[model samples]
Target: MEQLICLEALSVILGVPIKPGSKGMSNVNELNVENLLFSTFFGNLFNGGPGKELFVDMNGFLDPQFDYDFRYCNDKSICKRGDEPYKRPCGWYRFALKVLNKYPDGNTWLGTDGWRSHSVAGEWPVSYHGTTIENAKKIVKSYYKPGDREKYGRGIYSTYDIDQAFDYSREFTSKNGKKYRVIMQNRINPKMRKVCKRQDYWLIEIPEGTSAAKEKEIVEKSFRPYGILMKQV
Candidate 1:
């Protein structure tokens, strides 16, 4: 069976060789920087690895600002659910970029607010819905009822709806197979009665002889040398 490499593994692969010793070395800093650069470059090259699949769901990450408390040194509550522990969307995107760079021809999948719950507290829209304009429109249209526009005008739903719509629009399918759909909430948010940011997905049809795991392995191994990591997280 082929092995799937993750960011840590990729980091080890890229960082270990350059360093003379496993122990502390001042020059290790430089090597680390170099590794990071290499990783970033590799990520950009592959563009999030081969799958041609996009999954849309609620943002699983947390809001960095309000979700934390710096007042107490050992405050456990400071780290809200899905905040400190996970790498979150930013890291996920970086990792994804690496995968994409390796598998440029693979399909792209996207989910709704699966990174962070929609909010109005950040500079960039506090949502992970749409990364493109067309997607934004689709999200809005899908979520809001034709005449219930005024309700979501200024609430979190306003921003959330826009972001989700954008993501939906950006999604594309290269080849048809089984289109998967996941609905987190049956009804739309009350604030935005028309918008429903549900989760939907689809996987490309693998060749007849290839198993799903085998195909994933083949793709993962292809990008291993390029410093891109591939694994189920």
Candidate 2:
């Protein structure tokens, strides 16, 4: 059997060294549905300790109430209820595609029972509270090319400039012969209003040909473990 690669192991493999205090992981308290989804996906890919698993709360992911909240901000929280803020569909779709591309198997196995239970519906089919698999799949496919941006407009906040995003998109080729594009936006979280130092939103485009297995290998070999001869101080 192949060795399971955990997050710490992946860190050593990637050579993208992370210090103990590094902000590699986001805060769960501030996590919205999409953030949680991404976290769960990545966490499952690398964290392989006993009783550790990755699971999504279908209720939270698909609930129309929460969906509306996720898209808009009410009160100080960006994801508060009753606030119909504009959501960039293109960005959301892009995120889903990246995850699907990375985890082609769609194994959906990771994390503890508590996590798993919240992730699926009655029959073990991965179901979000109010979202259909069709919608999810549709979202993933929508962001395959630059043209899709017409529907959602330019992203508000992105780490890479437009040119870089376009260039990155060209590098990856999906199984279907389609290229990838990234749409980023800047979002203001009211809760963090006091700090007001962090930028709103920055979306990164995941180039094509990047697979979950390849990422796992990268994390395992380049990120997780390194040869270090320790010296006593």
Candidate 3:
């Protein structure tokens, strides 16, 4: 979320040590937990498609703050050499844009290649290449806006397939006006570890005696726009 403060609370809830010095950047060789979480959010929000368009202006600005030496193979050789280092913009700037775009103050759109020019040599969008360092900082600074940081806590950042989970489990509204689903199985993974089996299913009771045909009809209706076919679970 925005503040990145109260990480102790997050760590307790997520069962992951999120504090600084707990794990260095070196430990992250691939997509980290947060990135995967964001990816899940984006995947669900757009219904498995890149919906809408978001453009970050890259113009001629190169952020010095993100400037760093990156390793590259010289002469396409499989051997290491003295000329293997090159300066490039930080890749994390793209992640900053993702967070900025998800700001609750505005509708979040998928980042697109619309911002790039045809004359550019790069195949990917300039956003992938990066934007001006000033722009990058501004994007991250926007995360501090009031009501933005807490947006992630409103269930948008859940790794669960919210739409699918809601469809599978008839939604229920609680006395406190909170809407939730009582999914029967762990849609994320069927095989439950011995330690986690207890937490696999929603503990709340779901109404019984609903016909399978009726449930299928509801699922079909929900997935019609996405052109998905309902199959027996």
Pick by lDDT: which candidate is best?
A: 2
- Which residue runs of candidate 3 sit more than 4 Å off their true CA positions? 1-4, 21-24, 28-233
Q: Which lDDT tens digits does candidate 3 get at residues 1-233?
A: 22132222222223233333223334331222232223242232233123322121211111223222222312321211111111122211111212322333332122222222122221111111112223222322221011122322210111122233333333333333443322111111111101123221111111245465653333222110100111111
Tell me the deviation in Å of residue 222 in model 2: 30
Rank list by TM-score: 2, 1, 3
Q: Rate the local accuracy (lDDT) of all candidates.
A: 0.24, 0.24, 0.22
lDDT of 1 by residue, 1-233 (tens): 11122222322222221112223434322222222322243333233234322111101111122222112223222111111111122112112222222334331211122334322221111122222223222222222111222332322222223223333333322112321111111111222122324322111122345664665443232222111112122
Question: After superposition on all CA atoms, how large is the RMSD of candidate 3?
Answer: 22.9
**Top model by TM-score, which number?**
2
lDDT of 2 by residue, 1-233 (tens): 00111122223222222222222345422212343333343343234334333333322222222121112222221211112122222222211212212333342321122211132321111101111223223223222121223222321222112223333221222333433222222222222112112322232222345575653343222111101111011
Report model 1's TM-score to 2 decimal places: 0.19
Error of 3 at 203 (Å): 20
Poorest 10 consecutive residues of model 2 by lDDT?
Answer: 224-233
| Candidate 2 regions with alpha-carbon error over 4 angstroms | 1-37, 48-171, 184-187, 191-233
